[model samples]
Target chain A: MDKLIEAIARSGNPSVVGLDPTPALIPSQLMPTPGKDQNTAGTQPAHVDDGDDADRARSLADAYLRFNRAVMEGVQGIVPAVKPQIAMYEALGQEGVRAYIRSCALAQEMGFSVIGDIKRGDIGSTASAYASHLSGVPGGRGSSPWHEDAITVNPYLGSDGITPFAQAAEASDTDLFVLVRTSNPSSGEIQELKTEDGRAVYECVADLVSEWGRESIGEHGYSRLGAVVGATHPQAGRSLRARMPHTFFLIPGYGAQGGSAQDVAAMFDDHASGALVNSSRGIIGAWRTSEGYSPDMSVEEACDTVSQCARAAAISMRDTLLAALDAR
Target chain B: MDKLIEAIARSGNPSVVGLDPTPALIPSQLMPTPGKDQNTAGTQPAHVDDGDDADRARSLADAYLRFNRAVMEGVQGIVPAVKPQIAMYEALGQEGVRAYIRSCALAQEMGFSVIGDIKRGDIGSTASAYASHLSGVPGGRGSSPWHEDAITVNPYLGSDGITPFAQAAEASDTDLFVLVRTSNPSSGEIQELKTEDGRAVYECVADLVSEWGRESIGEHGYSRLGAVVGATHPQAGRSLRARMPHTFFLIPGYGAQGGSAQDVAAMFDDHASGALVNSSRGIIGAWRTSEGYSPDMSVEEACDTVSQCARAAAISMRDTLLAALDAR
Candidate 1:
C-alpha cells in the first residue's frame, strides 16, 4: 500500500486501469479461427468434435496477453495501477491464468502496481494458501507466479480467512482490500441487512476491516488493508469514508457500471488521495464503440486503435475525477 | 449433484477425500532439493540467488500430484468423491494450478466425483466468468481445464454472484456449494450476527441458498446448489439441515479439524442421503503416524505406505460415520 500510494503520487493519478479481457472484447483478427491453432495442443474432450479446446484456449490466452500489452502501452504512465480481473482469464482455464500472470508481470515491468481482482477467500489454512498470491511460495522465495501488488478478498468467512492474508501481505510488503460494499445490484441482500445492534452488515464489516488495517498504516496515512466501496453507493461510500477514516478505498463500478465521477467524489479524502477509481470496459473496451475502430482493420491496426482509445478514455476519466474532487 | 448422489449410494460412503497437500504435509523426500531441479527453467529473479523458484514450484506441483494420486488410489473404491482444495496448489502459482487440474482430471478418470474447493465470489459479471470452473470456455467448446464435478462458492456478494454459478451448474450438469456456517473459530464473527428479524446471518443465507436451489431439484430430493455446513457445529448444522431441505451439504472440519462423527451425524438426513463429509489431513496424512513408515523408504514405498494408511483410515472413518448415523 505504501508502494501503491507512492506510485499513485509519482504518476499523479488516482485511478487504476482494470484489465478485464473477454472474447467479446477482443478483435476478430487476433483470435485463432476454428481449425487454425487447434492443431497445436492435445485432442479435445470426446464430447466435442470441433477442435482442441485447450489449444484454442491457449491461443485466446496469447491474444489476451497481446491485448493487455497494447492496453498497458496505452495507459502506461497515465495510470498508477492495473487491476487484472482474474475471472476473465480463469474462464480460459490454466492457459488463461498464464496470460493473467504474464500480464501482471508485464504491468510490473512497465512500473505499474498490479491489483489482482481475485475475490478469493476460504478457511484459515486455506486462506494462508491463497495468501501466496501476495506472499509468493510458501517455503520458497523470489518472484511469485502471480505478480500482484494487492488482491481483493471476500470476508464472509470472518477473521480466520482474513488474518492469514494480512499476515502474508505484511510479509510480502503487499496489501489487501476487503469487500465492504460491492457495486453489484443484489449486494444489498446481505450487506444492507441490519443487525440487532442497529448496524448494517457492511458497516460491521467496515469496522472489522478498519481493525484489520490498524497495525499497518503507511506513511501516506492510509492502511495497507483497504476497503472496496463501490462507486454506485455514493451516500454509503461517503459515510463509510467518515467511519473508516484511515482506510483507503478501491472504488469500482465507475463509467460503464453507471457510477459517475460526481458519485465517486465523496469517497475520496480531503486531498483526494484515499481512493482509486477503476473502469474496465469504460477504458479497455472503449475501442469497441469508438468511431475509429473498424472490423476490417489489421491486428496491429486494431490494437493500435484500442490502445489510443483506451488511453483517451483513461485520461478523460482521470481529468473527470480531478474535476469532481476540485468541485467538492 | 445427481452424479455425486449416485456415486455416494453406489460406494456406500458419503465421504470425500480432501486433497490439500502442503510443504509441511508432504514427505521431505518428495520435494526437489534446492539446487537439484533448478536447471529445467530460466534463472530466478535477481532479488535472491536461490535457484529458479518456478522450477521448484513445478517440482513441488508434480510431487503434490503424485501424493494426491497415491491418496486417490488408496481411497478409490472406498470413497465416492474427492474435494481438491485449490488454494494449496494456487500457493505454488500456475504450475500448482496445473497440478490441481490434472488431479481433478485423474480423479474423474478413476470414476470419482471431484469437488473443487474454490470459494470464489465477485460481482455478477465476474461471477459469471468464475463459473467457468463448472461451465467451460466462454465461447469455446469441449473439456475445461478444471475437471471438477462441482465447486464451492462464497455467497458474500449476494444473488448477483451466486446466480451465475447456479446457471453454470445447471448447464454443465455440475453442482455448487455455498458457504453457510463455516468451521473456523472466528466464524461466529459475522455468521452468528443476529439480524433485526431475529435470524442469524447464516440462517438468512441458508434461506437464500435454499431459494437458489428451488429451480434445480434433482431426483435425489436435493438441489444442484448445495450448502457447506461444517461438522464442528452440530446444533447449527441440524437447524440448517432443517432450513435447507432441498439443498445438499458438503460438511468439512472432520477429524483433524475437531469434528467428530457424533458432531456431524445430526447433519445427515433420515437415510443419510443429503450430506458428504470431508477429511483432508486425517486420511491423506495418516502415513505420518503409521508404524510401517520409515524415512529410508523409496518414493514408491513411501507412496505405497501412504496409500495403505489412507485406505485404512478412510475405511475407519466410514465405519465411524455409519455407526453415528445408525445411532441417530
Candidate 2:
C-alpha cells in the first residue's frame, strides 16, 4: 500500500483502473463471432460454440482473462493499482472464477499491485478465513489466483469482522480498505443514520477506521488499514479525510459514477498519496463513446484510450490538490 | 427453504449434516500428501510434505468432502438439509474451494436442500452482489458451482446489507439464515453489547430476523428468513426461539461444541419442523474415537455408522420435544 502511495506520487496521478469485465463489453473478435449454431451444454445463447457447458464457460472465462490482461497492460505506468471487481468473473461460474485468478496473476506478473475489490465481511473465525484467502499466508488455506496487496472490505459485522483483517494485515504486511461511505444511491439509507454523538453512521465508521489504523502505520507514514469513501460526496470526502488522516482511501464513483477531477481533488493528501480514485467504465470503455471512435476499435486500442483519459484526470486532480496545499 | 421444512416434518427429524472439510483430516491414500514438494515457479521448500501440515490439511478437507457426499447420499431419505462450513474448505485453496462447490452440487442433486454456512455480510450493493453470487439471480454475477436454497448470513451491516438479501429471496423464493448468537467462544465481544434500548445486541439481531421474516411467511406457516442460534447456548436459544416463532432455526455446535439434544429441544417449533440441529465431527468422524469403531473400518462402514448415529440423535431429540409438549 505504501508503494501504491509512492507510485501515485511519482506518476503524478492518483487514479486506479477497475477491472470490471462485463460480457457485453467484450469485443466480438475475442468472442465466438464466427458462428452461432454450434451446440453443447454450456454454449451461450448469443453465440453457440463447440463444447459442453463447462467447456463453453471455460472459453468465455478465457476471453475475460485475456480482456482484463489487455486492460492491465494498457493501463500500466498510468494508474496506481488495478481494482478487480470479483463479482463479474464469478457470475460466469467456475470457469469465470478461474479466469479471474488468471487475470490477477497476469496483473501481478506485470508489476501492478492488485486490490481485490471483494467487499467481503463475516463473523470472527469466518472473517479470518477471508483474510487468509486475501493475504496468502503460509498456513492459511485456499487458492486465490492473486494474493492482493490490498482488498476492499465490508465492515458490516462491526468490530468482529474488522479485527481479523487488521490482524492479518499486521502479520502479513498486507492492506485492507473498509467500506465507510459507498457510492450507491441507497447508501444514505443506513450510512446517514444519526448516532448518539451527532455523527452520521458513516462518520462513526470513519472514527472506527481511524482507531483501527493506529498500529498498522507503514514506512510511508500511512496505515495499511484504509477506508473506501465514495467520491460522490465531495464535502463528505473532505470530512472523512479529516477524520482518517493517516488512513489510505479508495475512492470509487470517479468517472462512470459522475465524479470529476476537481470533485476528487480534495481527497488526496499533500503527496497525492492518501487517495486512489477509481474509474471502472470510465477507464475501461472510454473509447466506445469518444467522438469519432468506433466500436470497431480493437480492444487494445479502446483500453489504451481509457488509460489515457484516466491518466489525464488523475494528473489534473493531483495538480489541483498540490496547488491548494501550496496556497494554504 | 419451505420444501426443506416440509422434508423435516415428513422425516420427523431436524438433523443437518455439516460439511466442514479440514484438509488435515483426510485419509492418507489421497494424492498431494502434505509436506510433499509442491515447489512451484522454481521455488523449492524442503518441508512441503513432511509435517502434519500438508497431510492433515489434505486428508481433513478430502475426508470432509467425501464424508459429506456420503451423508448426502445416505440421508436423502431422512434428513432435510446439509450445511457446508466455508472456512473448512477455504483452507484448502483452489482445489478445496472446488471440492466445497462439488459437495454442494452433490447435496442438491441428491434432493437435499443446501444451507451454505458462509455467514457473508457487506454493505448494500456488495451485499446484493453476494446474494446474487449465492442465490444465482439474473443480474448478480459470479461463478459458483453450487447455489444453495438458503445461505447463512452475517447482518452487522444493519438494514442496508440485509434488505438486498430480503428482496432477492422474495424474488427467488429462497431463504436466508442470519447469525443471531454464533456458536464461537469469542462471540460475546460484539453480540453481547447493550444497545441504548437496553436489549443485548443478540436480541436486537433476533428481533431484526423476526421482522425480516414477517414478510416472507409461506403457506406452511414458516418464514423464508431464519436465525442461527448456537445450540451451545441453550438459554439464549430458548429466548431467541420465543422471539422468532415463525422463523426457522439452524443450530450448530450441537455435538463437538458440547450442546446436547435436550439443551436445544426448545428451539424447535411444532413437530420438529422449524429447527435443524447440525453436527459435523461428532457424526462424520465418530468411528475415530468411539468404542465400537476404529480406523480399520471400511469407509462405507464408517460412513453408515456415523449417519445412523446422526439419525438416532435427531429422532431422540424429536421424541423428547414431543414428550415435553405433551407434558405441558
lDDT of 2 at B308: 62
State every prediction's TM-score relative to the real structure: 0.96, 0.80
- Pairs of colliding residues, candidate 1: none
Taking all chains together, the TM-score of candidate 2 against the true structure is: 0.80
List the global CA lDDT of all models.
Answer: 0.90, 0.67
Per lDDT, the best of the predicted structures is 1
After superposition, which runs of candidate 1 have C-alpha atoms over 4 Å from their true positions?
A34-46, A49-51, B34-46, B49-51
Q: What number of clashing residue pairs does each candidate have, in the order they appear?
A: 0, 34
Every candidate's chain B TM-score:
0.95, 0.82
The worst-scoring run of ten residues by lDDT in candidate 2 chain B lies at B137-146
Against the native complex, each candidate's DockQ, computed on alpha carbons, is: 0.57, 0.24
lDDT of 1 by residue, A172-206 (tens): 78999999999999999999999999999999999
